[model samples]
Target: MTKLLLGRYLPGDSWVHRLDPRTKLMASFYYIGIIFLANNWQSYLLMFVATMVMVALSKIKLGFFLRGVRPMIWLILFTVALQIFFTKGGTVYWSWGWLAITQYGLTNGAFIFMRFVLIIFVSTLLTLTTQPLSLADAVESLLKPLRRIGVPVTELALVLQIALRFVPTLMDQTTKIMNAQRARGVDFGSGNLFQQMKAVVPLLIPLFVDSFGIAEDLATAMDARGYQGGDGRTKFRILQYHQPDIVAGLAMVLLTVGLVFLRA
Candidate 1:
């Protein structure tokens, strides 16, 4: 269960792992921008090549990336079907009673599907290399300026960190509950849409109850520690922007500019 939502965090001393979390976060944004900027096959090919290069640098196994993508298979298929059957403009490929499959639809569907896949894979690469703690720290640091506006940066960071940490735990709990239901002669897979929805109720109830219980326990623990929300907290390790981070950021800027120019 922990294995389900936590994704594959492959431990390696690769260049991606050594990159600053801020750099990776910004790069992810730039990468997504480029993905959306893509118009034709040429831009898509360039984006794919760039994504592949990032994956290669991450040094995570291809299996890990595929595993991350498995959950989105249904979504990709749904988008493809939606685009192919609904989009209109180009030559008609086929037509049914009230549905039309046009050449434009096919092209649009393929492009959207590939775009989604590339976005998912590239984002997964960022998470695979960057530690959760590091991500939280980077986010907190990035949002520090918001403190001037009376925003609680530390509390926000803490919430994000706890959410990330518990994601795997909650997934494990859900899997356990699902298996327990299955063992009790409950067929979750083999059912109509309504039946499947009904079957999930039992699973969801237990999951929600357990989640509340865990939240309560966490609150109590925090209370026992005299925890105050971001009053005057001091970090054990402060984040420093290194030269590599600056270089990476500049590269991302260039990538964004290049992609924008290509689109133009």
Candidate 2:
């Protein structure tokens, strides 16, 4: 759980870290969309290279991004395996009762694997580089135009920010609770499926209790500090696009255009 890096922010002054949060947020979305445009190995290779270059610019070690992928490794492998075994087309290379590995299956499985890694890597980069507050600001800014339609964008953004902030805290709390339960002879790891679930009840009860207590304390603190919703609130720091943001946008455009021409 501690290895979960999706919602946690790592402070840095690297090029990727210095961009406006809004830019990073939009770029991540753009990359995800363009990634699907890649159909051939050449297109995927180009995307892979572009993604790695972004990682390099972030200046965070590749290992941290990889660690983010580790938690999803099972999921990635399962999806890839499904594609490899279930997808039918092209030359059949091997066969078992109802499953067969074919050229198309192998190709599709590789593509799926690359897609999973690239998406996860880009998303992890966004969260690792952008502060929760900045992300909320970006969200709120992007959604601001919807306010005329009566959408509560401010409240929604605040909720998102709080959720992101709480993920790490909750993970740590869960870890501590697990250790305490272990000390009390509650074996979380040893058991059949049903038995494991039964063992988890004790762990969950305390976690829920603690979570509520934490929420109550936060509410009290917010009330004491007079955080009466986002009405009339002004940001201490404003988001502004710079030269790097423009360059980054241009690079994305080029990548998108390249994928269109290169994809089969």
Candidate 3:
């Protein structure tokens, strides 16, 4: 759980880190489109290559990104297992009454897993490169046009900001609670499934209590700092698009085109 890196930011001087948050945000959507557009092995390979290029541009270690993927490993496997056993049709490989495996099942299962992996990889890159505050601002800027229709973007942005901000805090608290429980001889990973769940219950209570306390503190601090919502707000560090952002944006476009061609 501690290896989970959603909404966490790491500071770096890489061009990916320095690009306009809006451009990065836009590119992320296109990248996600590529993930869905991947219909064959060739398309998947192309997407993988493009992602590696982006990772190189970010200047973050491949291992660092892989480490953050640890938490989702079980989920990916479970999903694959589901598809492999339940999906019907195509050549049957094995069978046991209601339980069966087929070539179709295996192929679809692998595709789903690869799709999830690609999504996670790109998302990890986004959070690792973009700071939380910058992400919030980028979101606000992107949704600014929606204000013409009265979307209440400020409240939405605040919610997103708080959600992103608490991910690391919750992760830290989870680690601490686990450590404290371990010290008390609570065997979290021992015994049956129910027993493991029982051990986790003790950890959750304290974590929730601490989380609420921290949220209260944050609200109080914001109130003390005169946070009167996002109306008429001014930015200290304004966002600006540069040549690198344009070049990166163009690269994303070309990558998307290549992925589409590969899929076709």
Candidate 4:
């Protein structure tokens, strides 16, 4: 019943929260690139240290960050197992019939697991501090040049905005539906894998029905307001990149360079 995918946004007055969404988005991309470019334990350790500093600066609780990672533990474990059993280089640590564990595999698995965890943690932190509307605005502004290529940047932004906005709402609805089913003697966790999946059928039906209903209502509301797409739409609040954003951008660039140099 716990919706782990719906990570909670913790409001804070930290430097990260003050950053322009566009800057944060670009930084996130650079950070992920650095994470993947890291090839050894030393570079990975440095990246981890840098990420921890960013986390501390964000002022969001460490507990929240760990909680956001809980859902991914199984996936991390699975990757670890796959790498440990399949990677054939280095000294063999264990051998049992067809299954083998090699030192190289273990190291590779651990690195990959940590890499995925850091990527998720850092990206989720960005989302935690950013408002969905602000993200939409930032994305729209960033993609404005695509308009020259006949791409509908405004429509793309609207879709991203709606998707972000609906995430929390959908999570809430799922919780409500699960609780209602629980009250009606439906047990989601008390059955075989197949049976448990079957239990979700009832939940899925209502979820879809309500999703369509909400979409219809939203369309009606927009239509009532004479809403038109991408046609001279004016914003009351314009996004501005300030000095702090510039500093953050520079820091991200430096971080990227440091990470690459450390790897080399």
Best by lDDT: 2
- Candidate 1 per-residue lDDT over residues 140-209, each given as its tens digit: 9888999999999989898998999888788879889999999997788667999998899999999999
In model 2, what is the error at residue 140, expressed in angstroms? 1.5
Instruction: Give the range where candidate 1 is weakest over 10 consecutive residues by summed lDDT.
Output: 1-10
Q: Which model is ahead, 2 or 3, in terms of TM-score?
A: 2
Better of 3 and 4 by TM-score: 4
The full ranking of all candidates by TM-score, starting with the best, is 2, 4, 1, 3
- Maximum-TM-score candidate: 2
Please state the error at residue 116 of candidate 2 in Å: 1.1
Q: Could you give candidate 4's per-residue lDDT for residues 1-264 as a string of tens digits?
A: 223433455677899999889998888988897788887888899889888988998998788778768889998889889988998888998899988999899889989988988998898888889876887898899999999999999888877878877887888899899999989988897778999998998899999999999999999998898878876888775788999899988887787787788885
The residue-level lDDT of candidate 4 at 168 comes to: 78
Q: What local lDDT does model 1 show for residue 50?
A: 75
TM-score for every candidate vs. truth? 0.75, 0.78, 0.71, 0.77
Give the true-structure RMSD of model 4.
Answer: 4.0
TM-score of model number 1: 0.75
Tens digit of per-residue lDDT, candidate 3, span 1-264:
544444367789998999999998889987897688888889888888888888999999888788767889999999999999999999999999998999889988999998888788898899899987888889888998998898999789888878877887888889899999899988988899999999999899999899889989999999999999878877676789999988988888788788778885
Question: For all the candidates, what are their Cα RMSDs to the real structure?
Answer: 4.5, 3.8, 5.2, 4.0
Q: For model 2, how does the per-residue alpha-carbon lDDT over 1-264 read when each residue is reduced to its tens digit? A: 554445467889999999999999999999998899999999999999999999999999988899889989999999999999999999999999999999999999999999999999999999999987888889899889999899999889888878878887998898899999899999998879999999999989999999899999999999999899888887776789999999999999999999999998
